[model samples]
Structures are given as structure tokens and as C-alpha cells.
Target: MLLSRKAWEIDLREARKMRHSEVLGCCPHDCQDGCSWVAHVEDGKVTKVVGSKEHPFTRGVLCAKVNDYQTRTYAPDRLLHPLRRTGAKGSGEFERISWDKAIREIAFEFGNIINDWGSEALMPLHDMGSAGALQRRALMRLFHHIGASRLHGSLCGQSGNAVAAEGHPISFDPETLAESECILLWGANLLSTAHHHWHFCLEARKMRGAKIISIDPRRTRTAAKCDEHISIRPGTDAVLAAGMANVLVEEGLADFEYARSAADDLDACLEEIKAWTPDHVCEVTGVAPDDVVRIARIYGAARPGTLRVGIGPQQSRFGDVFVKSLSALAILSGHWRLPGGGLSIEGYPTFDNAAPECPELSPEGTRSLHRGQLGRILTSSDLDPPIKGLMIWGHNPLVNQIDAETVRQGLCRDDLFTVVIEQFMTDTARHADIVLPSTTQLEHFDVQGSWGHCYVGLNHPAIPPLGESKPHTEILRFLAKEMGLDEPALFADDETIARSCLPDGFDWATLNQQGWLFAPQPRRDPASMGGSLKMSMGLDGPEDLNVRDPIAIGKLRLLTVKPHYLLNSTFANMPRQAGQQGNPTLEMHPADAKSLGLQDGDRVLAQNGKGTLAAMLRVTDAVLTGTTVLEGKFWWTANEDGSPVSNRLANSNWTEGGQPTFNDIFVEVTATSGFADI
Candidate 1:
């Protein structure tokens, strides 16, 4: 209430004054390119935004999304107050409620669910929405104390992290890429996906003459800018990677001694790749055998070639397998030791030490959930009484999940009580039993680190939380206290949580002033280099070769791929962004389109066994025949009577590691006449 009073006073002042200086802070959204922006406030209103020149990561640059902050921050459709559904579930009908009543209602329902079904039935789904470390960790601590069903393995980087853990000691620093002679932009588009990295890539090109080779199914902005683009079939990255390793071995381009030393079972691994010759791989990946060999040779011979592995390569059914194979290419080529010559996987560097202290919920014991199967978890009676209570934060499962219709059904279930904390009335929020207003990055203070860049940024609050919105940390703290959780210490302030993340003896004041933290250099020893090769290569063995089972036949293999623009549906609700790109549509190759009697821009019914969706067709050669590509950010919308559109294409039974593989589903497409343009 005090904050609101202050905000009102600021607003009144803004009406009297045209402009006023407001210190800028970093916007720590679930984006690879964390932007630095300064707010112009007159009274209490934000009148303008500009790039922060002092911010090292952004370097005074702001993306289109950041430039449109006014629309996103104070949009008419924003959840200005808490709301409880008054109409039937999924009806987009809600009545405004005060924060006091909202929180009390949520607590009462959640407590009742816990009392009746036990903690395991109450599932807390947390992702990148409120990325503040204290906020996320507090939820984990609360769930731990209350015995809630915990979400595990990470919907985003489980496979990539597994590869990084198994293969390298640390990711190749982005700064080192500028020194490379050659760079492989593997399965990722840095220009659109990781915008901040694009600046570095451009510098590497201009300064170091770094030759860029982009390997992806679509000709993205990065692909268009690269020196060469090798378009390959989706889900065949592993075969191509293995083929490269084979070429390195056969042409004597590999450091045989180093391979043997790095990996304990180097000889066995080499032998395993013998079957991955260019010809064999070409058959599977649809890439020419000679072209594969040529690319491999270029990569192997290039002095200090950097391999930047993108997250898209690891989104398939065999995501972990592909990541591991790619890592092997780097090791076999002996690229790991040189600067800018290693794998780079995208992820947020969380300082949360919950893993080291809480071994039960640590990274080691984390379970992998199928990001696509969110709907089934909510709706299925077979899930042992089903998840009774749900808490949605950071992520919008309705838009990001593979088969969205199923998720809608699950959310609409009478038995499933849902609470969504969000900035806007997202598709997922519309189905929630209660929706709580959440603060934007501009309203919170925290530190952020990028997987691409090494610099850690400090996010200072630039404006008061808008309307009735609350920072996620405060929400979790209040919940913890109300629930009487055992470890109240876990719900500490952002400053305390930030301090805990740093290594002991670090100067907090200096770090805040600098607005960035560089990871400490790993102590290097010449003695350690001798066994590095052996340690790296020792994992390859005959048994390890057959660890993964062969891909099943006859079933439709759906791969829910991310496009360059939207990565996991974060920017879907931004009006300016949505206006530019419109709603996400499905893309298929011309040959496949004709075979299915679908035309470009035609409304087609796309269905797997579980569900179907009607989407506008985008016919292009960019996608390979028989494979369909759809943008991953379309919120499931209902018909006039309330039947959801986007959810129609989801498969309920298709799950992997307790998560659904939306991308691994086999679907059939046909032109639909009655559908409206999506």
C-alpha cells in the first residue's frame, strides 16, 4: 500500500512535469539477450525508455522487444489487479478481486488440496517467468518443506547440460570466439535467438576473419549472414556430427594420442564411429556424402575452429544423444584445449546453491519432464489421482507445450485447482482458477548471467511495481510465512540470496558498483594437461554405444522445433512483436504441402493421434519434405463457444521422462475450409 501511494504521487508529479531522470536497470527476462534499459519517469509514470550505454552486456543496444516496453508494461489487457474466475473454466471470464481476498482464496484452496491429497498431489511448475534467484529458490524451499510435487530435469536444457557435464569441464567463453579462424553455428540462430551474441559474431567476422558455417534446417538470419549454410534434415544432427568425427579419424585430422588420453576408451569410440562414414550418414540425414566430407574436412583442418552448439539441436527425441555426439566431435578434433574451440550451450547461470545443500532436489537427482505433456499431467486420471493443485509461474505451458489442446482440457478440469502468477492474461492464465498480478523485470532488483556471455549483470529497480503487481520473491515469501514452512530462512531477501551465490570473500559492494561479475579463472597447471585427453576420451566403450534404444517405427515422430524469433514462447504476448509476426503458424515444405493437398497460407487441420489444430500453412523449401515446422508461441485460443484451437495438435500419450515429446509426434495435415485465419 505504501508503494502504491508512492506510485500515485509519482504519477501526479509526472502529470505536472514532462520528463524526469530515472536510473535504468537490466531487464532479466527469460531471454538469451538480457537488455539494459533506462526508464524516463515524470511523476510516477514511465514516459520513455532508452538503451543503457554503461551496461557492458547490451553495450547501449536494445532490441525491438525492449523498445516496446511501454506497451508491455502498461497494456490495457494487463492484469492490473488479482482476479478469480467467475464463469466456467477456459471461458476467459474473470472478476477483479483485491490482493487480500486473492491471496487468502489461493491459500485456502491450496491448503485444502494439500490436506486431502497430500503434498505430492500439489505440483509447482516454475520456469523463467520470475527469474529472480530468491524468488525461484523460495518456491523450491516452500515445496520442499510442504512436500509438494517438484518439477524436475529442466524443460529447456536437460539434454544440453547432460552433454556439458559429461564432456567438458566448462563451456567455451564467448569472448574467445573472436580469436577463432572458423566458427560453426550449429543448429542455432544467434542473430534472432541470441541477439547479444550476434554483436560478438560480427566482430569475430570483421576482426578475426572468422569463417562462419551455419548448420540448420531453416535459413535464419544467422544463416543468411554466415559464410556458408549447410541445410540438413531436422533430428539428424547426431548422424552428421558422428560423420564429422569419422572423417577426422580417417583423414588423420584427429589427435589420436590426445583422443586416447582425453577419453579412457578412445580406441573403442573411434571404432564405433567407423559406421558413421559420409555415405552412411548422408542416407540418414539427407545431406550429400561429399558435402558432408568437405564440411568435416574444413572444420577439422581449420586452426582453432569454434563449435557453438545451439539448444535447438537438443530438442528432439534423442536430444541427449545428439548433444553427446556433438561433444565427441570437439574432443576428437582436439578443439577443446584451444581458445574458442569448444561447445557453447545456452542457459542462465543461477547462483542458487540449493543443489549443493539440498542433494535430494539437486541437479544430480533432478528428474526430466517432457515439456510437451503438460496437458496430460493435468487431465489424465491415470496419473494416480492426478495433480490436484498447480502453481504456474515464469512459463506459459499452453503456448509452449506441444499438444496444447490437451493442456487446456487438463486446466479446465474441475478437480484441478490452478494459480497463475503473470504480468498479462496469457492463454494459460485464462484457464487458471485464480490469477495473481506479477511484477516485470523493471520493478525488481536482481543479478543476471548469460550462458552465451561471461559477464554477470546487476538489475536495479527502475520503477515501482505497476498497479497491484508484486515481485515474485515477495509472493513466495508471503506464501512461505502463511504456510508456516519449517525453513523460513530460505525466504530471504534478494540481497541475502545474491550474497549466498557468490564465492566466499567476494566484495559485494564492488560487484554491485561494477554491475557485472566475471567468473574466476580456472587454475591451470601443465601437469593437468597430460591426463586431460585420457579423461575426455575414456567414456567411449562398446556398451555405451548401445546405451540408447533404436527409434521406434510406425509411430508419428513429432519434433516441436523453435523458430528464430520465439524461443519457448516468451515474446508471444508483446503487442508490437505480435503485430509484426502475427500469431505463430505451421511451416511445411512445398513437396510435402502438395502431397497433403495444402497450399501456402491455406488453413490446414494438423493432427496427431492425440489432438489437432488448424493453422495457416507456410509452404517453403526451408523445411525438409515430410517434416512440419510450427512456431512454439501461439497461445491456445477457443472458438466462439470456447473450444481451444491450438490444443488440437497435441498427443496425450507421447511422453518422455515424465514429460511429453510434442516434437516427436507423427501428425497428418489436411486443408480445412471453415477455419478463420489464425
Candidate 2:
């Protein structure tokens, strides 16, 4: 058979294989897919990194963004040594510095900052950069040991996780979705952001014959591929859920038996939901009256349908309350009893407490800083003692954080001595006073657990450090020694730390042998759910759902849609990832585009006063007529002159959880004076 032309063009490599060994490790990115990956190592170098075919849930497939991470780790721009900044912030200029010198200088500066303004002045900004169980929270111990200021707020999945935790003892198991006869992907674009879970969703469709319904303002890939897509108004999720409850109770379709026991406060919840008629729901949510009845009928008709709520809808003012209302609606419809039927919140099982914890490091009475408000914390004069020094890890603030301009200004502060531990010269790293080279997951030895799937795995060193780079844990240990910290926990090696995180009799070798060990899966119905369902106030109906003008009324509500390839800003700097993303474009309904006197490909200015971003217009009716869609997370660092920058237009406001309200805003999109190709 002739080789396919496409296959023939594939670039082939012929690395000399001295000895090949399969090594297992887990992904360290802050993505929903927790992949148990396999590294094919030969001669102390990794030849290939692919998903572990043995991983039951992930089924050995990696997303487009992460599949080529081996190349990214070895990219020419990859940081290999510690460096001191030699140019203006964001200028990306640095001079190499020895590890000892860098550590000593950073420690000295940190001590001075602490001596002058107390430990609270020295802030550490870290996230799941390596997400290695050993590395994830390693810096916290150092910061806590030093009595640094505490960082608080729902920056990660905290907002959604908080609401779910209040009601459930354990997280709802997503694996049960395969048993679902009808699946509603609420606000989640699973195909793009959570690809691994999409497989089970497909089983619900092709195998179980489940009807899939997607509700969002834009025509996301997941929505476009689903059986039905509904365009709902932003922040009106509670209204739709409450309306569904009204219909379920009015038509006697609610699971009365399940509601009576599982949700004792059902009557009180119904009392509030009784006011939300289909018409009222339509008036508040952009969903039509008939669509509401149709969804309610389909959902109620199922023995117990499943509701998998996405984090996308939980970044608004009433995000927490919306979760509560959605929970009530699920119980009212008896959706929690089936294996694959229930509300799947953000959660993963535990194996010796996989999350990073250094609670002892938190000093009593320390001021708490919200991670999302980094901009405000840095720029606001009202701060009692402004942040004098900053240490960043894993996360890229210049692109991920809101108020891009504020972050830029804050990082530019001559007085703010910032140190960033990074694998590359990220947009955020460029703003640092001293940039420390950090190892990729391939060069780290640590334990890691998945928040998406039930798998606890280990990340063994697949290769030696490329340069003078070190793991976050090692760096923290070095700093602890430099600062004369006697805390034993502060200097634990990866093996010791990883071992401490597991329980007795845990098979340490299974992590590397099979690549993963399954944790105790979530129960179909747990008693802990009662507390949340019982304590929830009556559902918020149309009257309660009405959002007053958030400063103005006529402008279209804005939403950011993550491009299929670039899940976030992580791979934006990678050449291949950037090429796949192409130019940034803002999708608008044809009517909205016409209202702004713009056409397809026309450049438009989308500004909310706090920031101004520009993008080419894609005039399609895929989005709501009164809303615009900006695809993100944009490569702000790779932006060319006149290129679209989505974050520049974000309002930079904080949600109740302290996470940036990336959505939940309104903006005026006006035609630009001249068109420029992005």
C-alpha cells in the first residue's frame, strides 16, 4: 500500500537508542486532564513523551497543546541558568548569575525586606507550575516558615470547589457519566479544555444513547458538537436552573422520593423557585420559554440525568449562589442517585493527601492577600504596607492575571524587587529582578495527583537538568539553608516529601511501574451532600436573577473562549502552538457586528475603560446578539503591533472567590479607524 501523502511528510528523527526504558509520570499543568504519561528514555535523554496507554481513564491520549512538551522543554529560549535583570521590566534582558550568588542575593534582599516591613512584605506567588505533589506547595513551607503574608481567594477552582464542598463530603464522580442517558454540559466546553473527560461524555451519547445539551453564550466547539446548544445570558444560570425546578414541581416530574430524603429543604427551595415561571426565566435568561419547558421535560423524564457544571459559569458575582441553585435543581429532579447521573463539581480522590500543604508556615494574624487582586495589591495605595518584594513560580501573571496594565505597572515598580522561578522567559518572568531557571516536569522527582481523574502517579527525573536549573523544591531547600532556617520540613528531598504524602502500605513502586494508582472513587450518593442541599436558601428566581447594570446597560456582555489549541497562556510561546492559534479574532453575532457598523475581518476596539483590546471581527451568529466572544488565553507576549490582545480589555475585577472575573462583563465594540492584519 502506498504511504499516505500526509504521513510521508511527517518529520522523522533518528536518535541513537543506547537503552530504552519506559518511565511513568503525571502532567503538571493546571488543566483538567491529569494524564499518566510515558517517557521513552534512551541514553539519559527522553526521545518521546506520550500518554500512558495503561492509564484507564485518560486512555493514553494527550491534548494537542501538551503532546510536544518534550520539544518545549528543549526550546532555544528555555531558561537554563539563574539570571539578573539588566534591562527595563518586560524587556527580556538578563545576565547569567551563579546559583550561590543568586540564592544569597535573593535571601539577603528578602531578609532586608522582612526586616524593614516584616515578613508580610515578602510575598510568594506560586501555583501548580510543576504541580508535582512534592513541588506544588514546596514554597509555601519557606514562606510560611518566614511568616510571609498569606495569599487567599478563589484564584483556582476555589469558587466552584467551595460551593460544592459546603454540600458534599466527597466530589461527584465523573466516571458515572457513562451511565447517563441524558447529559447536560453546563457552561463547560469539554472538547477543548477537558478533552480526556470528553471520552466518557461520548460514551453517554454513542453507547448509552444520551442526548447532550450545551448552554453557553457562544458556539463553543463542545456546544457546536452537542445535540442541542442554547444561548443563555451571562450570570443568569441560576434563573434557568430555578425555572427548571419550577417546571419539575409544577408538572409533578420531580423525583419526590429522592427529594424527600436527600434534600429535606426541598419545600423551602421550591417555595422560592415557585416564582420563576418559564416566561420570567426567558425574560431573565436569553433562553426561550419553550426551550426551558423542553429541557425540563427531557431532564425530568430521565430516570436521573447528570449535570456536569463547568467552572466557566462560576466566575460571576453570584457564582456561588448559582452553584447552590444548580445543586437544588439536580436533587429536585433526582439526578444524584444514578451512577453516571449527578452534579459533577471540581474534585478528585485522595491518596495520602496529594495536595501541597504547609499549614505550619502560616503565621497567625498575617494579612491575607487575594491572588486574583495581585494588580490591586501592587498598584493600590490603600494597602497598609505595599508589597515590597515578590517571588513568582509556575504561574504567568502578565497574561493570566486581570488588569494587565496594572500588573505591568506594578512589575515596573523600581522598588518592587521581584524574583521569578520559571522554565522559560514568560511574559511575567521578563518583569523580574532576578529570574531563576526551573526544571520541567521531565527533570523533576516528585509525586502528583490528578484533579480531573482518579490517578496518583510519580514524576521521576527523565533527564538531568539542562543547565544550572533546579526543581522548585530544591530551590526552596537551598534558600532555606541560606536563610539559616532549621525547619526539617523545609529541606526535605522529593522522595522524602513524596513518601510523606502517602498513607501506610501504599505501593510506592506502582506509581512508576504502571504509571498510576487509582484512588477511591467518588460515591454515587454520599451523606455529606445533605448539608449543602439542606442549608441552601430558596432558589433564586427571575426577580433575584436580575443583574442591575454593572455600570452600563447597552454594551454587549463579553466572554472569553479558549482557543481549541491554546488552553491557556502556558504553550503560547511555543512556536508550533502559536502557529496553530494563528491571529486572535473576536466573534460577534451578525446583528451586533452590523450594529457597530462592522463586517467580517474588520478591526474593532473592545474596551471596558479599565483596559482596551483590539481584534478582527468574525461576524457570525454563533454568539448572542448582545454579546461578543473573545478567544483566549491570548499570547500577550507574542503580540505584534496592532495584533489583538484580549486580556488588555478585561476589567480586572475580583469575584467573591478572589478569582479574576474573566467573564461577567460588558464592553462596547466599536469599529477601528483603520484595519490591520493580525
Candidate 3:
């Protein structure tokens, strides 16, 4: 009675065939890469994930992270149902609950908190996790409608962006880099950190004959491939850059006429940088004085040299100062306006895309909360009130932020009610009183724009959301409705949201059909500057300026560093990536390691006045002898036995950008009694 094998297979396929349809979609993942992908659907299920050859940004290729779309969508660890904590907080105990009940409970508690402590008590900590335009806007709108406490200040790129805004705000198109003769890659390890850009850089080096100069504290993959690698002392990037400028001026390489024409106060800037001579810079940066001269001559003399400044440069105490100095260099060399020239603070083109006016969410008139003050907020000192309720989505601050112990204590507060929306049970999720399951990129429809490239991409739903999982926008809508608020204004469908957010004169339907969009060419010269120094600086030029005193003498700042790959802790749960480097470690020079009576792989305790974390020593000449490098991606949670590591030691000191100089806080390291298992 058994059917033939071929017959059985054919019959099974026929039985499963419910319908076939083509949909226009884009991958709405948190990555800056923003890949455009196609979904093959049969019987309401995604059968294949393919790159859209037509996508200008993706260019018919996908990364290893996105290639496993099926696995990530169907991962066993994904939250399939809403749950409420049934045990003590941080106990990781929960009970399954329906979505309706979960929404009602969340709304009630959130409303109560707002009534008692004002909207600022309920902080919604969000990041790139749910980057869809609708999802992001909906959350902000809901918070505004509910009068809930809001989170402000981006942990990423705010300093760099501010500096860029102050100068020539526009970004250079990525395609333009291919035409450059020389590229100065500073602090960024594009090869391992940004894979797609790494490919372009490699191509530019080998095929286009572009000379690449890498400047970083580490001998990264990007540095390895460069024509020359300049390893400077960490946190002293500004000093080195200033020295390079000094060399340019001294060697008669400065484009003084260009600076006078392009800058606001060329004489003041020149005077400020004059004291930063190569000899003085050599003493501070530890780079050879002659190397400074060589780099300045080459970078200044090269006809279309481009400077690509990495996010790492802005993660320290004087991050903003460093960015400003770098911008000043570009201005002095007349590299700010030319094609194949200028500096790139970040490769992402999303900044160039016009955003709707969101004045309510703006930081104006709001009491600022610096990211480094997590401990104080949790502890509820006399100066700061306790965070009564917390709503976290798309970001994992407990795992990523410095001073894990303080954050853990803050989350452990009995008075605090925490809600977490996530795809999986992340370290941050473990502390939540309520957990809402969220949909992945494969289960949603959205448009994506890259910070790295100019092209915008559209995402189509590749599969039905797994189990009861819902998109963040849906969750926001439900919460808004439950709170007795008008939900339409807060939540619009994906297509409508995308259309509204797109630049003027662009239609959503047209974008969907084409699967991408591009902005019009930028005007080369605005005619505002009349090619004269007097016109550029306006009347009363150099005498109208007031300069500040120089930085005081002190120990060089040593801040914890994180690359774009592990920006915060969102990606830590991805086994293939995070498991390879389980916890944060101390990166030190061999001489420094010896000075501290430590060796490679030895366990050491890195501590400041606020906290401490156990770290394994990794000795290399890449790090400056006086400084220590700690990758900032460790869960603040206690181990299986309830012991904390690196998060315990993060400094809570503040910096100008509302972020702590976590890296700049000097620490004393001592060899542990026992070495780490690694």
C-alpha cells in the first residue's frame, strides 16, 4: 500500500502549496550595512532569502550575519509568548501570559508611574534593535502621548555628528572614495569591524592604487593592509593630529589661502595649533618626530587624500575635541569641499536623509542624564531620583554600559517596574518584570537607509511572524490603545510611515517598485563665500575671537573601548560572534603587562573608585604602555554563582558629551589569585 518515493514527495509538495505571491520588501536590521534582500514565499512561509541584485547599496551580496536568516528567525531561544516575572527580580523566573493581558498590565503600570513620578520616571532605553521608521517613531509618539520619561543622547556618534554639524555638515558619498589617491584611515578597523567597507578599501588599495595610511593604537586588520600604520598613544589622538598640522604649517605645506577662505577664524586656528610642534607632539604622542613630518607632507601633498575618522576617536574623554581637531586639519588642507577629499566621521549616509521635525523628542529644555551616571540613578542619591519604571527596547544597557554592578543594583530595585521587548532572553531581558516577544526583520516590511552608503533600500516581509511575535510598531499601537490614547497618530502601517519619512517629492509606491532611492546631487559651491578671506571670516575677522586655555597636565586618559561590531550588548547573544570573545578583557602593552607584574592570559582586577571587573590580560605592543584597553561588552549580571566581572569597575565620571569618560578614568590593576579559565 506504500506509495512510490517520487510520488510521495510530489504529493507532499502539492498538499503544502497554499499560495504563491511576490512582495516588495527590505531587511530592517540594526546593522549600519542595511542590506536589501528578496523573500521567496510559498504557502505563507519564507522559503529563501536572496540579495536583491537591483539594490544599489547591497549590490547583490549579503554578509555572514544575515546569511543565516532562517536560523535566527527560528532560533529556539526566541520569545514566542509574553511573560510576567513570577519570582524575585533578576531571578529569571516567568509565567506565560496572553498579549491582551500583557498590554493592559503594561499600560496600567506605566500610567500609574507617570501619574505619581511624572513622565520622566519611565525611561524608554532604545537603540538600533528596532530601527524601522514606524517602530522608532511609534515608540517616541507613545511615550510622548503617555507623558512617559524619555531617554536622550546617543551612545554612538553624537560627538562626531556635533563636530560635523559645526563644520561642513554634509557627508561624502562612498562612491567618491574610489577616486581618491590617498586615504587616511584613523582608529577604524574596517576589515573586521565593517566588512563591506573593508572590501571597497581593499579594492581601492589593490586595483585603484590608493595609498592607505592607518592610524590606530592596535595593529588591526585594516592597519595590516595599509601602506603605513601609525600606532599612537590612546586618548592623545588630538595631540598627534595637532602635531601633524604643525608639521604641515612648518613645512610650508599648509593651504593657508584655502583655510582663510573656507574657515571662520583661520588666524585663530593657526595660532592655536602653532605650539603643537612635531617635537612637542612626539613627546606627547610617542610617535617619532620625523614620522609626523612624513605623514603631514604626504597627506598634505597628495592631490585628493581622504580622511576616514573612525568612531573610536570619539569614545574617550576629549572625543569631541579630537573630532574638532581632525576637522580643523581637513579645513586647513582644503580637503573639506573637494571630491575624493574631506573627512568622514562615519560612513553612514542616513544622516544626509531628511528627518521629520521631532521637536518634542529633542533634548532642548530637558534635564540631561549622562550615560555614565547609571550607578547614581540606580542608587537614588539625594541629587537624583530613583528610576521608578523602565521600558527597554532594541538596546541592552546592563550588558553594554560600564559599571555593571550599579546598573544591576538599579534593576534589582523593588520599587522599579521593568518591561523588556526582545526576540530572545538577553541578559537585560532577565531583569524585566514583563517580557514581550518581538518580530525579526524576516517577519516585517520596512525601508532601510545605510549610514555607510547613499542608497536607500526597501524590505518586504519574507515570512509570517513566528508564533505570537509582533513588530515593535504593533506593540506600540496596542499599548497606546490600552492607555486610552489615540493610536493612529502614534502608529501607522509600515508603508505609510516610510512614505512620510522619505525626502520631499518622493512617493512610497515608486520607492517600493524601484526598491531604492537616491538624493539629488549636492551643490558644489553655495556662492556664500566670495573666494576672499575677508568675505569668509566676515568683517572684524581675527580680532573677534576668544580662545580657551589649553588642557591641564595630568595622567593620560585611559577609556574602555568598543568597536562598531559590539556597539553595546545587542549582539552579545549571537553565539558565533560573542562566544568567540566571551567577556571584556584588558588589552595592554607587553611592557605595561610586565610593569604590573602580569603576563598574557593572567587574571587581573581593573578597578576605579566606583567599581571593578576581573579581566584576562592580553599583552601586545599595539597598546600604549601607559594605557589599558578594555572591550566594553560584558553582561553586568553575576555569574552562575552570582559573581560580577568587568561591569563592577566602570567609572561614572562625566564628559562634555553627556557620556562618562569611562576610558579616561585611570585604574590600578593587580594580579588575581587565580587565572581566568581562558
Candidate number of the best lDDT: 2
List runs of model 1 lying over 4 Å from the truth: 1-19, 167-170, 347-350, 353-373, 379-386, 484-486, 520-567, 638-660, 676-678
Query: Over the stretch 482-573, how does candidate 1's per-residue lDDT look in tens digits?
Result: 66655645466667756766666666676577556655344221123454432222223212211121122222233455544444666665
lDDT of 2 by residue, 452-511 (tens): 766677776788889888988888889999998999888777777777777677887876
Best by TM-score: 2
* TM-score, every prediction: 0.86, 0.92, 0.86
Each model's Cα RMSD? 6.2, 4.9, 5.5
- Candidate lDDT scores, in order, read 0.66, 0.76, 0.66
Q: What is candidate 2's local distance difference test score?
A: 0.76
Ranking by TM-score: 2, 1, 3
